[model samples]
Target: MNIRNDQYTIILLLLFFPSLGISQVEFFGYMETEYDWMEVKESTYAFGYNKLRLDYESFPAEEVSIRGNINFQTYHGQTIWEAFDFLPFDSLNINGEAVHSMPISFLDSIYMDNLYINAAFPRFDVTLGRQPISLGTGYAWNPLDIFNQKELVDPTYEQPGVHAVRLEYYINEKCIVDFILSPDTNFTQPSGMIQVKSNVASFDYSVNVARKNHLYPFWEDEDTVSTHRETSFIGGSFTGEISEYGMWGEALWSLSSNNSAGDVSYGLDHTFNNGLYVMLEGYHNSLGAEKDGLYDFHYLNYFSGETKSLMQNYLFSLLSKQINEYVSCSVFIFGNLDDNSFMYAPQLSWEILQDVSLSAFTAFSSGDADSEFGIQNQSFRVRMRAYF
Candidate 1:
C-alpha cells in the first residue's frame, strides 16, 4: 500500500498519543468485512473491503479531553472501484463525451475519521479539530442537516468526520445554543451554522440557520459544469412521542441568488408490546426534478450531502421484529413517488457469539427501465463485524 503525506500525520499522532501516559487513556475499535454486489440489466459488478478502526479517548485535565478514531481500510482484490460501474449513466453519452467518471478520491488512504480536543467550561463547551457533526431528527433522512449525507443501504453507518470548530452554551438542563464553523482552505468562503434547541413537554424542538459558499455541479446550457455559490438555509426540527408513538419532522428553506426552494421530511415509528416495530416517512423537495426531467441526483446540490432522492416526492416504510435475543429481521420499502419506482429491501442480523455479528441485506427494484430504481435489477450485500 502507498501512504500519502496526510496519512503520515495521522500515523504520527496515533503513535504519539500513548506517550502521555497509557493509564489514563482508553482504546476501543472494530474490524469489519463487507461485500456488495449489484445487477444492472445483463451486467453484474461486485467488490469487497476490510476495515479496521481504532478509537481513543483521554482526559488530559479536569475539564479537557481528547478523542479520535483512526481508520484503515483496503479493498479485497483491487484498490480502484470504477465509479462508472455503479452510476446509472454509461461511460459516454450520445454526444460521444465521457461522463460519470468522478474519482472517489480517498478510498485508498488511511486517515483519521475524527480527532478533536474538547474543553468544558462552567457554562459552555468548546470543541476544535476534525469531529463528527450531526443534527435533525429524521431517521432515514434529515432535511435540517446541511453538513452530511446518508447512505441508503445503511443509514446508520458512521459518517466521516469534518474539519470544524464547535461551541455549545447551555441555557438549562433542557435547552442549549450551538454554533459550528467549517472553514475553507481559502478562508474567504467558509461555512457556518447556529442552532437553538429546547425540550418541552413530550417533545424536543430546535430552530437553526446556516450559510456556506457551496461547490456544486449542475447541468447548464446542455452541458455539465461545477461552480461555487453562496447559499443560506433556515430550518427547524422536532422529535417526540405523541400518544405513545414516536414522531419527528424537519424542514428547510434554501435560498441562493438564483432561486429559492423548500424541503420537508417527517416520520413516525412505534413498537408494539409483542416486539413488532413499524415506521413510515415521507419527503418532498421543491427543488427536485420531475419525471420528464429526471437524471442522476448525485450531480445535484442535494447529493452534496443534503438529501437522498432525485425526484420531488418520496415515501418509505419499514417493518421489523426480533425473533430472539440474538436474531432480528426487517423489511423496508421505499419509492420515488414521482417516477413510480420502488425498492424493497429485507435485512437479517445475527449475533453468533459475543462481540461478533453478521448481517445480510438484499434488495429488488421495480419500475420502468427509465425509472430510478429500475436502473438496477437486483442487489445484495453481506457484512461481518467484530468488536474489541
Candidate 2:
C-alpha cells in the first residue's frame, strides 16, 4: 500500500484500540457545524459544513508518550465554480473525454491532523511528527512563527499542524531554549529554527533565528513563474505589563540573496474593572506595497496561509465585554492605513448548555473597489460546537 494509505490505516487502528499496551490514555475532541453567507460583488453564496475532530494521547512509559488527532468534515452548499478556473487542463479530462460538469454540493474528507511522539529526558524534551508550533508576541501578525503560518484576521482560530521534530531544554527556572527541524518531500531541503526564551522582572522575552525556503511569484517572458529561494530570518519579541496595562512587541528581519524585508508589530491591551477589555495594535511590513492598486491581485488570491494584506501599514483594534459567566461579545477592526480601507467584524458567543457553545459573527468591509477589504462586500457566519 501507499504511504498515505498506510498512515490512515495506522490512525484507524489507534483510534479503535487506543488503550492497547498503554499505561494511560485520554480521548477528547469536538464537533462543529457552521453556516456561512458570503457576498462577492453582486453574487451571494451560501455554504455550510459539519466537522468532527477526535484527539487521542497515550503514555506507554514514563518517558515515552504518543498523541494523535483526526478530523472529518463534510461540506455542502453552492457549486464551487472558482475551482475550475484554477484546475489544469489534464484534470478536466477523464478517459480521453473532457468532463465539463462540476458537483454542486457533495464532498467529505477524513484526515489526521496530528500524529506525534514525545520523549522526556532528564534535562530536555523531544517531540517528533506532525505538531503545532507558534512563537511570537504579535497578536495579529506573527512574523517570527516560521513553522506554522497563522490566519491574522482571526488570530484565535486553530491552525493546521506541521511535520517536524522539536527539542526543548530548560536552562533554569526562567530560561528555556528550543530547536526544530522539518524536512520537505525532497529530503534534501530542510527548514529549521532555534529559539531562546527568558523572563526577567515582569517582562518575557524571546529570540529566534531560522533558515527556510520561500516561494515567490515573478513575471518572466510574459508568464508568471514561481521560484524558491533560501532566506535567513532573525526575530525577537517581548511582553510586559506597565501598571495595569499589558504591552507587547515583535520584530523580524528576513535576508535573502538579493533582497531583505522586515516587519514589526506592537500592541497594548487593558481590561477594566467591569469586565470590559480593549486592545490596539499596529504593524508595519517592509515587504508590502506602499500603494493600493499594486497589490490588488491579493484579493483574488487570498487564502488562509497568506497575510491578510499586502499593504505596508495596518492598524487593528478590538473591544470585548463579558455579559455573564456564559456569554461574551466582541468587535474587531482591521484597517489598511496605507489604502484607507478597513474591515469590521462583530461576534457574539454563548454557552447555552454544558459542553456546547453557539456563536454568530459578521464581517463588513468598505473602501474603493480595488482596495483590500472592498473586494468582498460582507460575510456572515453562525457556528455551533459541542465538546466531549
Candidate 3:
C-alpha cells in the first residue's frame, strides 16, 4: 500500500474500533477493464482504467450502524483529465528521468474520501453523511431530478454525493414513506431537499420540493466568478405497475424558477417471463429558447456537465439465462432514441468462489456522438467482481 492508502486504512481502523465489540464487519469491491478500439482519433480503446473500493459496515447495536468506503481509480492519458476535472494538473507524464507529479484539487479528495452513518428506529431509519440521492426514475433523462446520468443510462452512475439525512418509514404492509434533507453550498448547498413517497394499491407516487444554492467559478479564475443560485428544481413523480407482466411506467416534472427553466419526462420498464427485460425513457427540458431559432433540451447543466441532452431517449434490454447454479449469460443492448447510437454487450459470468465472480464481456456502440465507435462506435471490456 502507498502512503495515501495506508493513511486511510489507519483512519478506517480508528473510526470503527470503538464499535467493534458488538458490530458486524463486511468487505466488498469490484474491478473493470475496457479496451476501446473505436476512437476516431489516434487513441486506441486502451484508455486503461481501473477502480477499486474497500467498504466497511458495522452494526454495533440493533438500532445503530456505521459505514466507511474508499474508492481508488487509476487511469491513463486524457481520459482522467477530460472526462473528470477532479485533478488540477492538465496532464501526467511518466518518463524514465522525471519524478511523478500530481494535481491537487477538491475533487481529487472526493475521489477517495467518503463516509456515512445510519441509525434505525422502530418507525423510521435515518442516515447522515456523504451519500447518493436520486429523486426520479428516468434513466438518462431525469427532468424532475436535479441529478441524473446519461448515455447508457442504465449503466451510468450519474448522481453526485451529498451530505444529507434520509428517512424511511413503513406506513403499512403496502405503503411506505421516504424523504431526504441536504445542505447545499458552492461545494455543497441546497439548505435541504425533501420528498414524500408512498406506495398504495397498484400505484406509487412521490412529491418533492427543493432549492439549490451554487457558485460557478470562471474556469481560469478561482476567485473571479460570483456565487448565485445556479439553479433550483422542484418536482413530483407518479408511477404505476401491473402485477401480471410486471410492467411499469412513470412520469416526472420539475419546475425551475431561477431562469424560468423546467423539464418533463416519461419512462416505461418491463420484464418478461422468459428472462427478458426492456426499458424506454424520454425527457424534454426547457433550458434554451429561440424565435425562428431552435430551442433545445439541455440535461447537462441541471445534472452535471457529463450529460448531454437533446431530444434524449434510452432503451435497455437484458436477457439472462442460468446454465446451472453458478453460471449464466446475459445479453444487453442500450440505445439512444434521439440519436442513432447504441451499445450491445453479451456477457458470460461464472462464480469463481463464494462472493467472487468472473465475467467476459464484449461491447460495441453505434452512434455519431460516441467516440468509442466510429460513425458506429465499437469497444470491449471484461470485468471481475467480488462482494460480501
Candidate 4:
C-alpha cells in the first residue's frame, strides 16, 4: 500500500468515457488523514499524510460489471519511506545507533489501486485485470498466501491489486473450485493457484496449491539485483466455531530449489456477554531464526513486511471493548517466544458523525537492547477517515 509511483494508472480517461450515462454506474470514495509521532531513545520526529480515494462501480450488462479505485496522496515532511522508515530504526546497523534517513522529494502521487471486470457465464464466473486476491484465514499471519504480505500494525488494511485472471466454478451449493493465474514478467514462469473450498458439517475448509516466483523482497545491499526463485506451496485451512469460542487454523508447506519450510497458525476468539471480546493466536515459521542477539539475523524481511516476526515462534492476543454506541477501545500484544521480546499497542476510536470516525493509537516494546523488540521506538498516531 506504500507504493509511491503512479506511472501505470491504466487508462483513467478511457475508463470514464464508457461510464458516461450508464444507468447502473455508481461512484463513491473516502478521504483519510493521519499524523504520526515517534520517540526514539534520543530523537523525536513527526510526519503526516492525507489521501483521497475515488472509486467507481458499474453494471454495464446483466452479467457484466466493472470496478475501479484511484488514490491521490500528499505528504508532509517526508514522501518516500523504505523498510523501517515508519519506525525510527531501519536496516543495516551502522555502528550501534538507530538511523532514520527518509528522503524528501515529490510529496504527492495519483495512483490507481484497482481496476477489474467480471462476467458471469453459464457454469462459472470470470474476473480479469488487476484485482484483489486474498487467501488463508489467519489474522496475524497468512502462510497460504504467497503473493501478498500483511502489515502487523494494520492487518485489515486493503492490499494492492494483483494483475490476474480468476475463474470460479460452483460444483454445488456448498462447494466451489477456484483458479487464479497471473503472468508476472519478473518471474521465470507464470504464477498461479488452484483452490477447492467446501463446507463440511459446521466448518468451512479449503485446500489449495500455488506456484509463485518470489524475490528476497528486501536486502541491505543497494546494488542487489532482483533475484527471483520459484517456490511451490501446498496448504489447507479450516474455520468454525466449537463450543462457545471461534476457532481457525492455517498451514502451509513451502518447497524451493534447495530447501523446504513450513508455517502454521492457530487462532481462537470469543465475545462475552458484557460486550467484551478477546482473541488469541500463535504462529510458527520453520524458516525463522532464534537467538538472544539479533545482530546477525536479517531484519529486512520484518521491516519490509514480508513477515511479522523474525523468530521461529510467536504469540499474539487482542482485547476489545465497546463503550456506548460511538466509541470503542482495543489493545493487542505480540511477543517473540524465543528472545522474550514483546510489543504492546492500544487504540481508541470514536465516531462523531455518520460515515466519519477518528482513532488514536500508541505502541511500545519491551526486550533487551539488541533483541527484536528492544531497538524499536515508542510511537503515536492519530487518524481520521470520512466515507462518502
Better of 2 and 4 by lDDT: 4
Native-referenced Cα lDDT, model 2? 0.76
TM-score of each: 0.88, 0.85, 0.68, 0.86
Model 3 ranges off by over 4 Å: 1-42, 76-113, 138-161, 169-177, 185-188, 213-232, 249-252, 256-265, 288-327, 367-376
Report how far residue 55 has shifted in candidate 1, in Å. 0.5
lDDT by residue (tens digit), candidate 3, 1-388: 2234455446655765677546667766555443333343233434545556666777877787777666766655334322212121224343534423343222222254445678888888888766666666555555445543444413554344556677877776655566666654443555455667776676677766766553232232456545344455567777777654333333433343334445566666666777555665555544321222222112223235422343334455666677788998877776545554567878788897887777776777666542222234445555566664
Model 1 alpha-carbon drift over 4 Å, by segment: 2-23, 77-79, 91-107, 215-227, 255-258, 295-308
lDDT of 4 by residue, 1-388 (tens): 4554343454634664366357477889999999988765555667888999999888888888888788888887544444344333554455696556645454577777778888999889999877888888988888877667776677788888887889999898888899998887554488888899998888999998888765432232356565445668788999999888899999877655344666899999999999899999999986566564343334655545445457789888989999989999999898888888788999999998999999999999898755666556688999999999
Candidate 2 vs 4: which has more TM-score: 4
Each model's RMSD to truth, in Å? 3.4, 5.2, 7.6, 4.5
Model 3 TM-score (2 dp):
0.68
Clashing pairs in 2: none
Rate residue 162 of model 1 by lDDT. 73
Residue 276, candidate 1: C-alpha displacement in angstroms: 0.9
Which one wins by lDDT: 1 or 2? 1
| Residue pairs in collision within model 3 | 36-45, 37-45, 183-189, 184-188, 184-189, 184-190, 185-188, 185-189, 373-377, 373-378
Q: Sort the candidates on TM-score, descending order.
A: 1, 4, 2, 3
Model 4 per-residue lDDT at 220: 25
